[model samples]
Target: MTMGLPHGLDGTVEGREYLTFRIAQEEYGIDILKVREIRRYEAPTRIARTPAFIKGVVNLRGTIVPIVDLRMKLHQDCRPVYSEFTVVVILNLLDRVVGIVVDSVSDVLRLSDEQISDVPEFEGAIEVDSIEGLGTVGDRMLILLDIEKLMSNVDMGLVAADA
Candidate 1:
């Protein structure tokens, strides 16, 4: 299901499902369609010269997938203790497979167009462009992200140069 379409989308992002996960104290969401699978946290084979946020690579059924810590990339101060709750969200982005380390996955939430709101344009550690919108559910607010855009940018270095 569609997660974050551009803010000006014509109310068509309704009834979309998003995979919610926690990073620090904030909750974030990704399009369920991009999710390949969720695996328990594992120390990947360290790669030299890679960015500190890039946790390295892992062999997944013969395919080498690069892992990125979402918290570290976002500059969050949360303790990254790998445990049963910690997970690596495997995502298939633009035909490339990449994994993201998240604190804990919450649930698959269905959000309507009205439930999402545009984020004010402002520069931040993470690009404001990467944020799809903010979603509300009861008392919880989920920060919906444009996973494709975020992971395809120059900093992510996961997708191809022109992807």
Candidate 2:
């Protein structure tokens, strides 16, 4: 499913929409087009030997969707505690269906290209390439993520390495 984006006369996108959510104390945004649905948190059937971030898979209708905890995947300092606000954001990416666990879901904001700033150089473990950029709206700053690239990363083990 695709979310409409405003386009310029040259057939290029002028602005894009992002579905924002909170991982911990920080706000993050992902391409709205990639989002399928958001559901309340539920314990998924455990799959042994998988990485810690791979919470497990849930049977969504006939499709088994792997659930990844964004907090653990992002290496957040706090241990994840599922609460009333916790949710799963199902995503359709690279022809695969997956779910990501987050603290809460927020607004869908439309941002012009100029509203985004290039990710600054940092000395940390977070993969800089997975970050699309930092978006500013008023006093809020949203860390925009390239979710497709992140899920497709070799470390994720969600897809084939060559994919």
Candidate 3:
């Protein structure tokens, strides 16, 4: 991991590492530094009255961590079966730990300034304000996400609104 202004800042993006994951037909990436570990899909304990996307909690080495399904949260058609590709990405956000279920995790990419582009305004879950930017690697375009913002967004219902 090299250096880039904290969340898609400046005109340049350099050497920052990102962990890529797939949800629905789209590909997304998040900062590798925030990731704690990756675990296989395990049926988490259900907590009543929470949003469907909030898949409840799991015990990771005795620490209970909330699990959120990115696929369901973003309104994507989920697979009826949880296969080997299904994974839970454990992330540490603002000192609190949480897990996000994703279709599959690809690889860690190191991008330079030229490989990245600023986020353009879009009307959807993957939008300018919620994303870090677009990263280009080879012929593939990766939607780099500002995971912190996406997780903390009002619609996500993970954190309380400041209103």
- TM agreement with the true structure for every prediction: 0.87, 0.90, 0.84
The list of candidate 1 runs beyond 4 A from truth reads 1-14, 76-79
> Candidate 2: deviation at residue 44, Å?
0.5
Per-residue lDDT of candidate 1, residues 3-69 (tens digit):
5542335655456789999987899999999999999999999999988888999999999999999
Q: For model 3, how does the per-residue alpha-carbon lDDT over 7-35 read when each residue is reduced to its tens digit? A: 34664444788999998788889999999
Candidate 1 residue pairs in clash (backbone atoms < 3 Å):
none
Error of 3 at 82 (Å): 2.0
Q: For model 3, what is the error of residue 89's alpha carbon versus the real structure, in angstroms, after optimal superposition? A: 0.4
Ranking by lDDT: 2, 1, 3
Using TM-score as the measure, name the better of candidate 2 and candidate 3.
2
Instruction: Indicate the residue-level lDDT of 115 in model 3.
Output: 83
Model 2 per-residue lDDT tens digits across residues 11-129: 77677889999987889999999999999999999899988889999999999999999899897465899999999999998889999999999999998887899999996546899
Candidate 3 regions off by >4 Å? 1-14, 76-81, 160-163
